[model samples]
Target chain A: MIATTTENDSAEHPAVPTAEADRPAQSEARRRRLPFSPWHLLLAPIAVLFAFPFVQMIMVSFMPSRDINRLPPRFIPTTVTLDGYRGLLERSDVLIWLTNTVIVSTVAVGSNVVLCSLAGYGFARLRFRGRNVSFLAILGTIMIPIQLLMIPTYVMFARLHLLNSLAALIVPWLATAFGVFLMRQFFLSVPRELEEAGLLDGASRLRILWHIVLPLARPSLMTLAVFTLVGSWNDLIWPVIAISDSNLFTLQIGLANFQGVRRTEWSLLMAGNVVAVLPLLVGFLVAQKHFLATMSSTGLKG
Target chain B: MARSATVAVPEDASTATGAGRRTQRRSEQLAGMAFVAPAVIVIVGLGIFPAAWATLLALQKWNGFSEPRFVGADNFERMSRDTDLVAAAWHTLLYTGLFMPVSVVGGLLLAAALNRRIRFMGLYRTAIFVPYVASAAVTGLLANFVFNPEVGVVNNVFRVLGLPQQGWLEDPSQAMVVLVIMSLWGQLGFVTVIYLAALQDVDTACLEAAEVDGASASQRFRHITVPQVAPATAFVVIWQTIQCIQLFDLVYTTTRGGPIGATTTLVYYLWEQAFRQLSFGYGSAIAWVLFVVTMVMTLVLVAIQRRRGGEQPA
Candidate 1:
């Protein structure tokens, strides 16, 4: 292993070596007690403001449809019913829609993890002809507003009979430029010495990438997976345009149909909305650390 | 990482009698190509290929099922006369102009708050960040319920406070305002996170030095902290501007470019033309208009930055 684990050019966030856990006996318990501030009061309310929506959504979803549409809306549910969630799961195509969404997002996350990690390694650490040009070409596409490209992409997909299929939904997401960029940024932080040592020991390039670099890349891979999952799961516009078969609709498109089912049925729609947003909410909670790091490190496309 | 795999070829192997080095070099090249091939192919096919094709398709007249006929500059010419496209364009600019500043300044203020020595910081962070994770489509849907004229929480609060309940999402002028509020609420978390990170990296040593000079907390923040996060602020502005320009899903779910198209942004207009109207060529033209508008705005922002004494942080 290299003596220095940090890369010189990885300027985004320099790695700081953690201080020794066992301090000398004379200096034991030296950590200071921080002073208090009244900022907690200001912050608590804003936090409540941001988090109250999900609570409201959950509360309303359980209330009977009749209760939600009354003249004065009730903030507290007097009687919670499983009718909304039950009607959704049993009476509608919600199950199939959820299944399709999971399948699409899973495939998207898996492929993006594999492909973006590989391409990211290539761009970040390898030297090949046309490397700069290729990277630039990919990066330049980020600024091309999706609107400018959607019309022709739809036409092309239509011509190829890819419409109404899961392939259409999965194609554009298979390897995003953003994913590649994110991976590259992470890979750049990996010191080159580890690979050189592997090379000296007669490890092949792919073997080195797989055995050494990939293990070190788990954090970034997880971040990318979560991002891709959230994106593909929450996607709405493309699915609306590409998939016409109700059987193939992702959660967003399928959930949107709730609006049409009952124009102003707040309870049914809120239940569906909660169901649609639940996975991501859970996913974020599960991967909160990585999500925070990823957001801070990169500028995600909204 | 093994960049030498293809650097030493068979010829070098023969001359140097260095079998290990030669294999490694050749292997590196082949492996690099194999590693990147899948993603590059997809990017080229779905991304670069369509980008080029769109420019060509914009010059023709064809629906999804039909044969293309050359229309020369007809679509672009027609765009100049499209009132809906024009209105959408104006609304998009308004959205960007208003939303960009609020998201940036509000985020900076929130980040400044979060950066303090406060208790339950993680709880605050988690709660504040919840909205940002929800998809705009979901946000828009939930917001519709929250801002419903009769039963919405806003009206309910207005009633509790002994005030008039305004027509929120229903009225044309109020519709855009509600949409902007939704956009701000959802985006506030993201921008705050970015600013908080930048705030943490704001050279605490400099602030400590300023404290030695007897500067007040606000003064140190005004001088050291704000100036330190200037680069991040610039980035947030540009990034948020790009996002504002692509405002579609939320509008798609809530407004659908309605209330007489008051809330129609450029993207919504583009979708309507291509998908709803099946006017692919005209839609492509409108898309170009959006692309151009984004470019001009970005350029203007950059130019203003250049003129404002570009004092980049080290």
Candidate 2:
């Protein structure tokens, strides 16, 4: 049923945008007809409820310890203070953790973009022995749960003496199967004629990829980079298992340890959370449309 | 040079002959393999190779410091008699049972509500989706503060509303419930965004035509909109189930498998067994069972989607 629906939908209505696109004229017409839709009454309250945790997290991070521990848990702090942030900075290796995370994420994004695109283009355009088999093998690996891989992976890392260092984090995120699959899908949708034209002009395959294909693939590359950055930055379980050194800990591992040791220090924990989450939040807000578009499009196809 | 070879072979095939074509084909093949080599090495080295090693590890007795000794099916036999594993399995089932439907259905309802042209639609969408981007560790930390028994905001609200206060994460009976709530808070936005994308692609021409034929709004929606988004619904369901089965991060950050091990999902249980207790073989056995269960569940879901209406699982 799924197969049929996908085939028929694509064949029948090709013009329908897969990603969210603004239709200002239709929205303007609807706005003139009904100044307020009844849906807003329901959505507005639900939005507030959904957004409450984030608001609370930020507010609680600024509140003094006593205010946070108050009986009637004040929504608005009577007085804002820098004590929580100051304590987090003094008590934890949060700055070092932040730097480590940035390094890991930056390396991950760069590697995934380069490696996945090369493999994706190879699978999409070239005629080679075992291309389909190899691609399918890589895709099948995506379904293998990380739980299954960890025990033996840990053993392997132990044998190689790659444990308790950043390489343990960096190696696994170098090139993901999901990244390759996503890039291949994007490449397949691109017009073959574009590459053929380059071929006609005597461009090498690598030259064509760099000059013709990569420019057109900017959106998919950004999507891949965003996903890799977020995944590596937020990764906790693996880092917790692999790196026990406090100085080498990423932001997530540090925050988890911080929470365990200082359970009663609500302000400190909240401040750590805000610090860990702010960079991503800022990135998402700045590229809201691209972020939303990439997520929705990839979700539907994958 | 490969570039010169291409340049020498002009558009007219009559000028080049079979040798030129063969040379070009060989070069292309070489280029393809060169492009794919790095990815293959990483994926096989890290992903596939480790998986094969895990299968072997499941049959061995290892404690990290000693050499692994092959023990055949002893590890698998141990699983049959393990009570903690049974509890963890049941907890995983309970989590999947509750989380999969509620999030998917809630997403559909919310997507429908937000589908129409409205002011501040982008703002509403952003507010909902913000939680999905937050790390599970952070969400778990925030959940502890918000749901704390004594000084939590939820309890304070309960007191104001004249309701009895109750222990949340500290109470074994209520800890799983709290975990589920936190998970939904973080995941519902993802499901909603996918559904919203599907809803936008529903054929508006068909809906307008139905309206001209005097069909009621609810009738058109039930018959038309529901069928159109079936594939996305299937995708969301399967994806959410996989996520629920792999529940670890939130449990680690919030309960640490909890007050009485009440919230110990399978992954957390395996992690503790291997990492904490140094029973690598038994942990690998649990991991294998989990992998098989996930594969079966995915197959079953895909089969159901096929039978429903030939809707392809995205």
lDDT of each: 0.77, 0.82
Give me the displacement of residue A216 in model 1, in angstroms: 0.6
For DockQ, the strongest prediction is 2
- TM-scores of chain A in all candidate models: 0.84, 0.86
Put down candidate 1 lDDT per residue, A85-165, tens digits, no spaces: 887776568888889998899889988998898889889877766678888888878778788888888888888989999
DockQ of each two-chain model: 0.37, 0.41
Each candidate: how many clashes? 7, 8
Error of 1 at B3 (Å): 23
Reference-based lDDT, residue B172, model 2:
90
Enumerate the chain B TM-scores of all models.
0.89, 0.89
Candidate 1: residue pairs that collide:
B4-B25, B5-B24, B5-B25, B5-B26, B5-B28, B6-B25, B6-B26
**Tens digit per residue, CA lDDT, model 2, B1-314:** 12223322222221135786776787777777777777777886788888998899899998888888999999999999999999999998998888877898899988877665456766787788778678988888988988998878888889999999989999998888889888988888878878877887777777778867877667877888888888899899888888899999999999999899999999999999999999999899899999999889889988897888654333
TM-score per candidate: 0.89, 0.90
The candidate scoring highest on TM-score is 2
- Model 1 TM-score is 0.89
Task: Candidate 2: list runs displaced more than 4 Å.
Answer: A1-35, A297-302, B1-18, B209-216, B311-314
